[model samples]
Target: MSAAVTPRHARHTPGLLRSIYLPRTADALAFAMSTYGIPLLVLATTRSAALTGLAFALEWIPRLAAFGWAGSIVDRRGASVVFHLASLGRALVLAASAVLLRLHPSGTVASVTVMALAAITGVLTEFSYIAVETAGAAAGRRAGRRAHRVQAVLLGIDQTATLAGPTLAAVLLLAGLPPMLAAITVLSLLAALLALRTPPSPIAPARTPKGQTGVGLLTGWRTIRSLPALGWLVTGLTLSNLATGLLQAAGPVIVVKHFGQSTTDVGLVWSAAAGATLLSVTLCRFAIDRLGQWPVGAACAVIASLATLAAAQAPDYLSYLVLVAVLMAAEGGMTVVLRTLRSLVIPPEKFGSTLSATILILLLPFPVAGVLTALTPPDALGHVITACALLQGLGLALAFTRLRTDPALRT
Candidate 1:
């Protein structure tokens, strides 16, 4: 009876994983397309690095602001409802923006229109993100001791989307803007359709007092405190993102203005980086099983720091591109570590709220990075990248030291 049951259970696992992966893949690809495509559009229209950076800033500000409420909604409403609704909302917004852009092809009006879409979509993206993260965590919990494997698979899916999204978006952009916008809108609606098949949230709705929704965020805060290792990890990752964000926000400017590369080559750089990251994420599953999460995470941190510092002084586009790939590979490894740790440490009932708070904390530097990119001249981006790299190294060192010693972190 036990042996028969084991086989039966194995048969059902893939279906469950698919339920999560399919929708998540669609959603992530659409997001990645918009993320890179929007900045490219802004740069193409305005021909100003400053404006490109500002557009990047606009894209992230509302995302940061929405995390608190997005988390509360996910916790109270359940993941499926939040995920489906947010996906539909994003599709509608993109459709409207696409139509409006056709009317005003190029001008201040077009620029403002895209920027407004960026802000609105940013908020909707957060809601979907929080919902999917909650669902992923629930799946991880079901996997018990093998939860890290689930995280690795999910990270791999995300990297796969990243690998494809930019290249596809750039190709569509070549044909024209409408095609790219239509592609993103279609993917988003597909995500909504797939969301209907996802498993219902295992966490019971977090009961809040009447008009006391603020309690959700407060709980997230308290959960972070209760998990000191989580707090330290989030803090260190936040600092590391400053470097990554600066690199991302300045990528179009650096490639176009500094290296004299075409827009298509810009997409290729990220595609290559995402390929490296996907490989790294795959290797991480085996590495964690053998050497453990902390050791693996620490090694990735070292690699990312060294690679970033080197990239900042790269002598040519080829060397910079290679170094950036290395940096992102390391970043991917770190992400697997972070996600695995989160699933293991956070309490399930509070997972959605805590996840949101932690993501908000981690993303805090993105807007700052955008602002820095805007202010710094294109020629000086290298120096800014170098400075951010040093800070990332220092922060990671302190964070890992604390994490190693923290009683909450199980070996």
Candidate 2:
């Protein structure tokens, strides 16, 4: 766990996201887009918001445990083989569910079927995603910086769905259900085939039998505890991820209640955020290398917190869009910098596991925030999310200082 600070280590990873890892990821994104559609489906079938959130969170929850093992496996092996296989497998899972949904459009069978599919796909996507990213990120080596850019690119492609998927589902509601889901099924299969073609991750030095310790579960914990720099990096990232989750939890609450919009409106606004995230990531390649991790992360966090608060105050569409743009932009740079620092901080053998550990910590907050927001008033939730974001910004600001980096940067 080295804390070499900012602007020094190369953290580029390219095309890996779209090339092979994407097929399944795209499907997952497609499904995530369909989350907006779920409430409508539930409304049509049973009208249960609780069930809808349960299914949605169910889709999201598995990653917390599954990613840990998946990350360890990637570290022991190379990224390509595991990534491809996982994509292929999840495609099968979706296909099966699509068939079940098609067969029973209005019954408990359909509802249960869709929920199960969403949950399984959600777990697999993040599980594999953590590994691919761990292998990529760079500052200048192109591979280092490329990882986040690759993420950014996929995000751009998926934003179209964020922009379109919910509306498509909403429109399809008038016509019927079978045709719309059938279309999604076809797209999922296409992406799966693409994942099959993703090239072997061009990681340096390759792997040796010695590197396959198969001890990934405990590796990140051990490594971070041993290294001060890595510890600070993980702590900072963990806080950032937790805060992001809190913010995410508050978005839907605000959209549906405050704005007096339907589920489709919520999806549309998130799509706007996704679009901004895409742009932010694209611009980060040139800007991130020169700016480095600390300043980039700190600035983004601070701005995002303010933007979130502003989102609370935003009364109309224009203000909402602007606020969402700044908030999304704030998130994207940290995605790049965080991955870059993680790669630079850890040894190759422990890369996947350590990254997974960090991700798991980040992810764990998601369900907690979801439940918390469900219980609390939206205004309180907004305040809580903003405060959490501010704390993370302060953490990043601390990392921006030389103390966290002095040990690792000194070489």
Q: Which stretches of candidate 1 lie over 4 Å from their true place?
A: 1-14, 38-57, 96-116, 176-178, 199-216, 249-268, 373-386, 405-411
What's every prediction's RMSD, in angstroms?
Answer: 5.7, 5.8
Clashing pairs in 1: none
CA lDDT of each prediction against the hidden true structure? 0.81, 0.60
- lDDT winner among the candidates? 1
Each candidate structure's count of clashing pairs: 0, 23
lDDT tens per residue, model 1, 141-172: 67766677888888998888777887798898
Residue 360, candidate 2: alpha-carbon lDDT: 71
lDDT of 2 by residue, 72-97 (tens): 66765555455555656666775676
Relative to the unseen true structure, what is the C-alpha lDDT of residue 274 in candidate 1, on a scale of 0 to 100? 89
**Model 1: which ten-residue window has the lowest total lDDT?**
3-12
Tell me how far the alpha carbon of residue 405 in candidate 1 is from the true structure, in angstroms, after superposition: 4.8
Q: Which residue ranges in model 2 land beyond 4 Å of their true spot?
A: 1-48, 134-180, 198-211, 226-230, 241-243, 252-265, 309-321, 378-386, 402-411
Question: Candidate 2, after superposition: displacement of residue 215 in Å?
Answer: 3.5
